[model samples]
Target: MSRVVFTLALAASGLLAQAPTPGPLVRLYPVALDANGQPVTDLTADDFKIVDQTKPQTILAFHKPRNEPAAPHEVLEFSNRTSGVTPHATVILFDMINLLDADRLANWKALDKALPQLESGESVYFYVLNLEGALLPIHAISPPAAGDKTWPQGVATGFDKVMKASSHIRQAQIGAEEQVKRTFKALEDLANKLAAFPGRRDILWVANGLTTVPDPMLPHCNGDWVECSLYVPHLGVTLAKDRVAVDPYALVGNISPDVNYNMDQMALLTGGHFYSRQDVRAVVNQVTQGAVGGYSIFYDPGPDNWNNKWHRVHVTCERKGVKLQLRERYYALPDSRPAVERMKAVLMEAFQNPTDLAEIGVRTKISPLPDGKPGVHLDIRIDPSDLLLREQGGKYSGALYCLVSDRSATAPLGEPSVLDLKPELTAEQYKMVMKNGLPFMQDHPTSDTAREVRVIILDQNTNAVGSVTFSVK
Candidate 1:
């Protein structure tokens, strides 16, 4: 049996320079804003205070946006993208579930003016939530065509079609409670779907329901204006998992004190900004800017902090007049530990949807093993510069967890092979790998079958994943 081998400049160090797979730590994402409502990216670790369950926790790691040069070395055969930048999208989700006809007309007028003003180089999608909480795509979500500048015309065309058909369809006469339930369900479904996208997406939720109506599914019965209306309690956590921000833009006639309060909660809970008194184009630009300039906070809450209850998380900047947008609460009891179970889920998701992941730059080649043994050789080329590495005590360290498997074969190569490599290197070795990417080699015993063979890799530190799937005949 052949074991996996990594070829790189990893010197033998006694200080445990090879990073160990760390336990799950709390990761807080905060989007800071200036007094004029713009993303603030220059703040450092000392500028903020984070309190969990009313107790201050020491900041273990602070990660700014990955501003490194995305270009790979000229010697590498393949990298993440040839475009030299990560692709993002703007999703405009309009809620037509309970909109009055007059309000719809007003939105149409505003959007008509805003559509021509919308400027973007990334993907953009437009959809509507129908009466039954099903998404009706006005313009389906897709990556922008290379060198295609006519997308704005396509958006105008799609909107024109929806406008012509709007007069014929009547709004469903549903109860307030049912409408609220449907709105919550729509948001849940949308978040799950958006997880497949590549980078962080900004959702322009042009809705009249989620903010204007109080949640009916919340178990408590206190009828206070803003405090009583919890949007089903679990909605915030669900949105946070998908790496998408929910920027709520209320319709013209739906603005109320209760509506504004609920809208603020939706934005705060999902690390998004409320687009009040703004046009569609301006809102998209600001939200996109925030996504580009957000910062991530990592703090290790010891095992004793898991009290199996919901804990409130408060992040405030020491600099006055600066506002921070972040998730307000986190459940103490996560679904599973990250060592085995969470790693398994990450592998499965990557293998199942290999094309959707590209954070870690990787390329692969498969062929018959040279040892005259009945096995196939698998070689993976990894770009080390894309990984999140930590430098401590004159050494650089990073961890990688990988899986290689084929789900279709039962007679052979059915069982998934899991490999974890945590490499620690001296400063010289780190410089060598940075100049020339790292190479990985492995082999799998298999029979003659043409099936989907997938190799999934996960960067343990940042949870960045990449995969490659090919058929072996």
Candidate 2:
């Protein structure tokens, strides 16, 4: 589903005000290993230092190895609150866009052989990038049943069928340029979806390799006629020299430099690793083993210049004989859109994969109104402490954005609502808000045919999102 509803309740309401753009808060997932290449789990924040562009940055938050249990398949309902709290998720992406037919088959066989070795509490999702550029989820195998330790037999069979079908479809489509574009876009989308999860995320990209640049013949032409010869004819102009012919099949067998750069960036930003041309068995083994534990470090790069430049980050340990792996850089400029507008964009993206985000906690109740109106009463409660609020001029200020939608009709029930909280309260009142939580109640018209209701909530101050889906009964 492309859209999900988000609901938020704040203590106070006022006109929405634009806050100054703050520097990006960069979160890194660093893996420390000993000489034997075993994961090192004993390191603390004081033992490490982060340097950005040669400037030292103070670590804002540090989390130790967080290894939580994976949600079971039987309890994996998308419309429930508890199902959203996945601590770790691993996506095994089979890149059909960049792999040869022989390599694809070999990798598939290798993954098939290694599937049974997955550990308990490991949440693994299998996705394939087809020729049409869709990142299709072929199968998901959560922790097996209580007594059963092996991968589910039915799930494995379903995966095989889906993979075969996807491969056939991808093989029939022509043109490498389109494939490259689609693959990169899919990777970016996946990264955004995973941003909502507050745990370790590993993307095991199994492919031949990636290119950093698309085919020169199919260069991205953004209004420059010289660069986009395809537009020359439409512009009533022709080149004196013979026009450079575009061989659609020329990029069919080769990777580009741009693709390589894009893939590497996605892996680093999301605290995941990238692999290419590796044995499927070895890749699977590494992913399964590496999923055990990792450290998350948050740092705020103070006062961005908005120069829109890439800043390199170097993290090192004070202790000797330990190697660290983490993302190297992040952009300095913030999203130019207003915070509320950005929140809406984030909400739309989160709707594509609602379960990926579980930062904010919420409870929702829906009941038919006793007045016999053709509508349902919606009550939503949000923990105030979960929101990132700032105290300004003796008042606590925060912002919230909420949306409710009908999944079947693919339309919003009403215009999105924004709550700008600026409550001037005594210390006792503030404490009460923290303890009792923010509660909001509203009644909205509904249709009998609408069987599902999706709600999405966003804390504009923090950009943390919480989403829930409920059956209309």
Candidate 3:
């Protein structure tokens, strides 16, 4: 992945504060297949039970896939929903980084033959998992097409580019250890990107299986300290070194377990499926034909301590002869600075992609600044209620982290700003703030060549993000 550098500056505002209390609600996307391996869509909330850490939890809401709008509207509406378990779109991820040359070619051939069978009303996205561990979107096929028997022109063009890029991976001289790291990094990045989209995304991962872990004894450890040895002169002992053997397959041995676990977890968490060296054409056909069925179950797993623990989840149905395909565990994110900082880093990495994180609602306006330094006055409006806030000393408080970048140059146009929302307001002032929304304005210096401006905002309390892009003419 590429690094996005930003110079951050704090704007004096009242909202700067610590994290808020953890919220309720843990959502799960589970697909139930009968003895025949077909989706059981008729199951209701009463027919299902969810166990978190072996404790039965109430199912607060359940949504089964239903008829939705076609094409662009369907994509737009699905992405915009505040809550619900609707089927979003299918993202066919070609993991070229992990697949051997022959497997890559075979999977490519499978996809080539299966593209024409895509459902006309479904939005399907194509991505190539590059060696750098990024799920790069090549093309998106929306609905209302002439027929299901053909692919859009863009799909053909994009697939060609994807194949061309992936072909080089076959010749690239990357070791198994490096490959393992890149593959999982790609999966992790892909999950974060998909989280912004509402509803369940069927990720048809096409690749040979990846190593679940990488060897800790490998030389030039690539920042993986666990695999790096530490020589302590005082103790006269080398820690974390079993032997100095140049075993090419060592990476595979170390990573295979983790790769398997992550693949399964990724599928469950994203409400997708993992297909390892399977008949890609058949899987695509099955997915497009609606042969697979699932339900989105939302429930409150209760309050979390944010101690960064993995909570196990088990789902079963009252109906007999049904097999559940779902993620077995979910990690509770750490509330500490390290974890939050890591999340911020991940969010910054995702900024390089074309998709904007619009999970949180936001509106922006930009006008030329009067100072005449090729600058613009930017204004943003955010609803206070949409944010998670804590009350202390008779005042509401929150923090907002904002980033403004020149997309044309892929550089920060101005220092990133942090706005604090500590307000000890009177009853009338509180009403006004709630009624009118929290408003923020800043002047940013821009170059004459800048064609686009990207603004990203992160809610410190909830970690919710909202982003907007403006074209400069």
Maximum-lDDT candidate: 1
Lowest-lDDT window of 10 residues in candidate 2? 239-248
Q: How close is every model to the real structure, measured as TM-score? A: 0.77, 0.58, 0.51
Per-residue lDDT tens digits for candidate 3, residues 1-473, read 01123433222232232434224446565667788877677777788878887789987546565333322322211222232223354556677766665556655666665565544424555668776566677654333321233453336567877677756654567666666567545544444444444334455666555453433445545632222323111001110010000001111112356555545544454334554444444555545434236565666566553344446677878999987776555555443454345445534643554555544445566777785668678776664544544455666666666666665744444434343343345555557867665677777777667777777766654555666666765
lDDT of 1 by residue, 1-473 (tens): 12243212212322122335455667777877888877676788898898988889877667555444565434323344444444456677877774555687787667756766677535677777765566777766654342343455557677767666755666667777677677777777777767776656667888654533454554574643233454544665577677777888874676777667767777766677777657677777777666556676777777777665556788889988788877776656555563544544565677666253766666676777777776567777776755767899999887787777664532224456657777788999888887766667888765545365667778776566776556665
Of the pair 1 and 2, which is ahead by lDDT? Answer: 1
Model 2 residue 311 CA deviation (Å) reads 1.8
**Local accuracy of candidate 2 as per-residue lDDT tens digits, 270-295:** 34455554454455455544434466
Q: Which candidate number maximizes TM-score?
A: 1
RMSD of 3: 11.5
Error at 280, model 1, angstroms: 2.0
